[model samples]
Target chain A: MADIPIRIGIIGCADIARKVSRAIQLAPNATLSAVASRSIDKAANFAKANGFPPEAKIYGSYESLLDDPDIDAVYLPLPTSLHHKWAVLTAQKKKHLLMEKPLALNVAQFDEILKACEENGVQIMDGTMWVHHPRTYKMKEFLNDKERFGLLKSVNSCFTFFADPDFLKNDIRVKPDLDALGALGDAGWYGIRSVLWAADYEMPKTVTAMQGPVLNEAGVILACGASLYWEDGKVATFHCSFLSNLTMNLTAIGTFGTLHLTDFIIPYQEHEASYTTSSKPQFNELVTGWVPIPSEHTVTVNLPQEACMVREFASLVENIKKNGAQPDKKWPTISRKTQLVLDAVKASIEKGFEAVEIVS
Target chain B: MADIPIRIGIIGCADIARKVSRAIQLAPNATLSAVASRSIDKAANFAKANGFPPEAKIYGSYESLLDDPDIDAVYLPLPTSLHHKWAVLTAQKKKHLLMEKPLALNVAQFDEILKACEENGVQIMDGTMWVHHPRTYKMKEFLNDKERFGLLKSVNSCFTFFADPDFLKNDIRVKPDLDALGALGDAGWYGIRSVLWAADYEMPKTVTAMQGPVLNEAGVILACGASLYWEDGKVATFHCSFLSNLTMNLTAIGTFGTLHLTDFIIPYQEHEASYTTSSKPQFNELVTGWVPIPSEHTVTVNLPQEACMVREFASLVENIKKNGAQPDKKWPTISRKTQLVLDAVKASIEKGFEAVEIVS
Candidate 1:
């Protein structure tokens, strides 16, 4: 006697939803129940192209998807500016919410969505797939080991991708009216989240935007960076860009060890992911080489990271629905913290790159 | 027939000298001819313990070693404060010089040493051995390839090592009267040098130090970082510390490719070094993984990087000695540029983390 799968409805035909739809199919605990696009023909085409189940419903408008009583949750991959409106409505309709990150335009918008989810007793989790990867768990274990890693000292994370000319000119990310936050919201989100994750979610004392951020004519960021400082002498810096090649790096250093990975956001292969770690490395006798070199750890993924993310989210939703339990606060709490740091970095840049003290 | 090997005398019995003495012996075109210390017994012991030639002379003072006509060049590993004094003396004595990095306390002091070398017609090179590694040349080829790497966009380099309490209290690096720049010089040197190497030695337009630099009681920096901006929208940041586990990372991103290495300062093994490069990598169709994944390149070394450095320096000295060629200006020019950026970072920190414009 297996439990019924969580029925997940995707409320937008965004490019990212295509991947998430596949993930929903791959996740054993979730099933694609519905998909919606503003136009009926587009919704039908997306459903047909993405291999939506024969029983999956196709809706011309997001409101219809939210009204579907069979749907247990909604995966919202809308642009940043639209998150608040749709996320709040999805929560009001009592559907669990799985939202693409830059969770909201700012913390305030995200707070409203959280409030809605709380009032409706619905689970909410941001769509940051990497955190759910089994490899991430192994890396966190390394970071938390007192004998190996000791106290955390610093972190440096970067996520950059070269945006082709047509995309830069027309992509919703570069349009101030649509995504608005641009590269910082789209890419810097991962960097900020990685830093916070490395620090065990301890908020930094201040965030300072690095000089020379590149912006488009519409006042949207194309490339940017920021440094964060903690009261206890820990420091981190992150850089994100749409003008550079695809490179994702996360490096965390502790008193006695270091952890590094280049493909933090996306694995190089679907079935496996790997990271490198060094603990108490020493120089060779002649000082010409490392005595004990760093070691690489690879985690075999039974399912892709995105599918793992879907399974985790759907499991939370099932707990809330089938067990009559409250919505999980952990996911929303982490999402809000990431958005808080993102806001600070943007505010610091707007205030002439001055230090912005994080209130929380 | 091969030309006579360059006879190199080392001034100062610093721990680094023991390694370089071995390098000089291993270098095909160099031979250790003498060593000097404030105490003749120390010099004699170092010469004997480091396998210096049995006929090698032992001098009680640096001045005496500089005066030895049989020595064609000198390796200077004295404290940073003494670099201005001994480096100038080595050049004035017409001995080609291989001096340790953080060439001087400031560019002004380094410029004076450069002037002395110019006037004496002696070659001078800093002991930044990694640039001489064969792997570095391979990496450069990728960076310079337009089809593979495209235009350089950013770089992030870090070098850190945990220092015991004894070193924090007694090491020359932490003493104001000795290596006054502290970790900013001793550890930050490699970070800055790596950034410069990745950027093709092009000077950045501005240097801004990151906030929250940790300083000792004597106002010596124990940890610090900076961001450098180039006029062409290229950016680079580096962090260096004496308070974290040994970690060296160099990540460079271009429009079409990325280059990364974990042990950029010292190879993990004496016989070979490796780096990773991703050229025009693409996400898989479902966005769960990468297509045409990154490739690792390994370069075998016949001798250690330090030996390679010594051989290159000795070969330059031989060219000037036997071919009547002028001393190569390339090495000093790069050393000066690196020092200039370092000075700007220090100035920026002192001025409350303001951005400091680099004149040259």
Candidate 2:
């Protein structure tokens, strides 16, 4: 059965929106319905420059797009400070919401956004695209295998990128009033999400910030890390930065096996992704080397990860529109948990790097 | 120079000694001269099992091996409690010393042992075989390359192995009177050493132990970790455990590059080793993947890493013997710094996981 493509409208024309606009067009079930910015010409220019379809409407402001009856879903790529305000508006407008990460500056704001979506009966999901990659599903198979990966033990997820002086001075991410959480909310969202994804969304018992966290003049974290400990003895750590060379590394170790990849958050190529797994790895006699070497596993990327995210969101919206099913709780639940841990990390850092207990 | 092989004697026929005995024999400038244990039969069997030369002597006690005037050096793989005693005795006997790690239970005892070696003018080195591997040198090349690696930023080293119940109860490592430090001394040694090696032997200003460290009923650490903070903003972390599957992972990130290896303490195959390097890696236009994928570098292992350690130790001994040169200070200096950091970690744990400062 061929379902009608869900009409998608861009709520803000951030640089990331260009990629998401492309993803919207690439997603078979998603249609690029509208583009919106504070300036009508800027929105039209963005649409033309990003290859938005000719029929895609260009609105002078986000308020105009929100009021459009033709739009079924809104993709919000505004600064994190604006997420609470716009996400609630999108939900209240009866439009499904697919928003950029760091869903809000804090968990309370995130819960308020989720509450709006629930009351309006609208699907809500954070735009953490990599989780939708086919490679993620393939890696999950290995993690679920008792013989190969065994019980979960630890995880290390790192996401960092070198930001030039110009970005530090002008990018909305570094502005105190825009993306106030700074690296913790921007790059660290992926690291925290990756850790939660690896742990199967089991929230940690506590988070302890690492020492020597760097801060900009406005007290925004430029680089920071935290260690998360679970009741089951599984520990995880993540480091995010805006002052280092671009790097994405993820490692998950189980009782019987280990998984490693240099670019887990994003594949080196859009068409393919790879990871290494070592099952029951042991050093050979004399401990000079390993016995059963780790094997590399590559998964074909059927579609760009962002496109997969759009397709998945649109499919969920379609199910709700056609079957009268309740909005999927999985995505919102994951987004909330990631936000909770992020809050705990910030609290720990504020408390002089003490271990902050995570009640949830 | 076609120098004669330095005669080496093994004190205590521990399991590790079996590996080192073979290394002594395999080294071009090192010969296995003797074996010693509480029982002459045990020593004889160990010598025969390790393929010691036909002329290799067997001693029923360590005292007898120490008295052997023909022996130029002693490879001590004894328990942690025995290090200070045997190392001082071996040095006093006018023989060079190659002792197993955790140089001593604490820095004070380690210094006492060092003093004995210095007074006797005997060369000393810890038997951390991985550093002698050719792969380590190759990895250092990438790290030291100004264009490729830039200045160091951070390092993380993890070494873990699953120990069966019987081993946990019966192994010398678990015994208070034997290898009392347990996993911290055994596995954590490699982790700490790797972190120090990556930092080029710069001692950290502070060490903070991670929370939830597991300790056996005997009050010995079974699993633990610590973060090291340097004065120059370079940070390092290490985790070691006896409750996880065998794993050796090391990651070093610099301003412009990153290096990753799954088996840094030991290679996956004895004949060769490989590591991944990401030099100035960046994302593609849409951030779907990396611009340049991290490349894998492999180095052939011409000699077993352990043999390389033995050869290097013997050559230093030969230099002191033939050239009448003073014993090299480099090895002992590095060993002291590693022990200092280890002591700080232990102190942090003992102080209820508080940050312990390291003075020099």
Candidate 3:
């Protein structure tokens, strides 16, 4: 007999959830079991608009969705302020969790949520879809090659998108009471994560926030940057903004090579993604040109990144539910490290841009 | 009648002089008139190897070359410590100056050179060749466009090259007694110049050197970075190194657009140079990709950028020599501003990475 797919329910109909909802439908190992919203009309409308299965339940509240024993996993896309409560509750309910990024408002809250997941033996992974892309794996291979890339020396990652007037005035990201971390939590998460990914998840010794951060009237960050320093003299800087043009760049330089890509967060196309690498390039006779130019490598994707994320999450869920396997610590560990660095940047800004030491 | 090409003498046998000597020959408005070194045989061999014209003279010492009344200008490519003495004498000889950069050991010394040029009515332009590239002008047009680029917000510039062990031990750039400024003067000059060019040559309010700069045993910097902050909330950063793979990148983000290029200091190809620009890019439906992707533009080069630099410098010299016009102040002004910022970064590093205010 064919194995049953993991039954997944999404709690909260966030705008991003619409994308995840489609990903869940596309993933072969997962099935959308239900969706929840505070209002029954919203929940029912979201399910119908997203083409949910006819049998997929529509719960009026997130608590009702978690109460359902048939739901094997919860995809939580609530505002960051609400992540701690909903994420911990989902873990306590024994559901594998696909949590939205900035995993929680702070590392302490994330630690509590992580503890709950461990106690319940549930797998938890943040919804950073790009890391699951095939292209990312290819890039990682280049970074890991000792002869090609050599020792990591520096990395610079940036992600910025100009927020329209409507978004600036009405979006939850700008409201201090809502997504209080604003641009740092929302956009900077990718930059910091990319840096960590390049450094092989080695935490930095200190974080120094750049001096001039733009903040909204309610004290929510609209733009910011920070520099990270490691014990081995490796350094990295990242900039993120909701007030500049849409640009994503990751540049990692080593003793022997450089890796560069402009569209790291989201591919310019759905089918294939590309990155450029140069290994020990030499100058021409007159130093007028490169003798061997940088090469661009493309990875063809069989499935979109989000769907791949769903497949991976569901596969882990199936292993634990059917084969009695232990939860994987790799995913949650990386998420925690990303969150810890994010917290350091925020703390450095709060402390008048002083360098904040990262103990962990 | 065709105008006479400006007769240019090279003052030192520095490795860079070989390239600049070739540039002088290639420029339509300039000619290689003579070469000078402490050893007569070295000067004669340099002139012959670089294919200097049969009529071109070879001088046993820099003083003899400066006394050559036939030479209309001098291209001084001496070490940082020698720039002040040689450049001032070249100006006193009534020859226009095309001096290699880090114009002097400090801004004060640069100011003395500038004063000598002013007193002698001789044109002065530092050897920052990339700015002479036609592609640079195109990038500037985008940055200047009010609708397309909007307000300038941030810029990041980097230039690095892997130096061989012999060079690390023997190159003048790594010797405090010779160049003193080290990588900051050699490689960092390009990064700092690119940042200033992107910012329209505006002076920053303060400069903060990054904490973990690498210095040689003789207290000469091998790698360093700094952040520049403007009063209007604009910010920029630059990193330069002598221990990393050869990589050059300049990224400038405005409110409505972004401008990026990987080979800003030296084009990957001589015949054509390219940069990428994105104006008001939008995310595709579901935010999986971008709509109306960033565009790459290429500018064909009729003459190499270094030759273009020689041509521009020669043309300025011609106007003063033939038309009896005053020397242009634009080039020296920008050069001064660049040196001022460089001085601030050096000061910040000496001050334990403290923020150093730019009084200018």
lDDT of each: 0.94, 0.90, 0.94
RMSD (CA, Å), each prediction: 1.2, 1.3, 0.9
Candidate DockQ values, in order, are 0.88, 0.73, 0.87
Per-residue accuracy of model 1 over B1-360 as CA lDDT, tens digit each = 467999999999999999999999999999999999999999999988999888999999989988888999999999999999989988889999999988999999998999999999999999999998899999999999999999999999999999999999999999999999999998899999889998999999999999999999999999999999999999999999999999999999999999999999988998999999998888887788888889999999998899999999999999999999999988889899899999999999999999999987
Each model's total of backbone clashes? 0, 1, 0
Give me the candidate number with maximum DockQ: 1
lDDT by residue for model 2 (B1-360), tens: 567889999999888898888788789998999989999999999988999989999999999999999999999989999999999999999999999997899889999999999999999999998999998999999999989898888888899888889989999888889888888898999999999999999888999998888889998888999999989888888889888878788989888989888888777787888888988887777777776888888898778898999999999999999999999999999999988888899999999889999976
Q: What is the lDDT of residue A257 in candidate 3?
A: 93
By lDDT rank, best first, the candidates go: 1, 3, 2
lDDT of 2 by residue, A236-258 (tens): 88988888777788889888988
* Tens-digit per-residue lDDT, B155-237, candidate 3: 99999988999989999999998899998998888888988898999889999999899999999999999999999999888
True-vs-predicted CA distance for residue A34, candidate 3, Å = 0.5
Task: Tell me the lDDT of candidate 1.
Answer: 0.94
- The model with the greater DockQ, 2 or 3, is 3
Task: Give the worst 10-residue stretch by lDDT in candidate 1 chain A.
Answer: A284-293
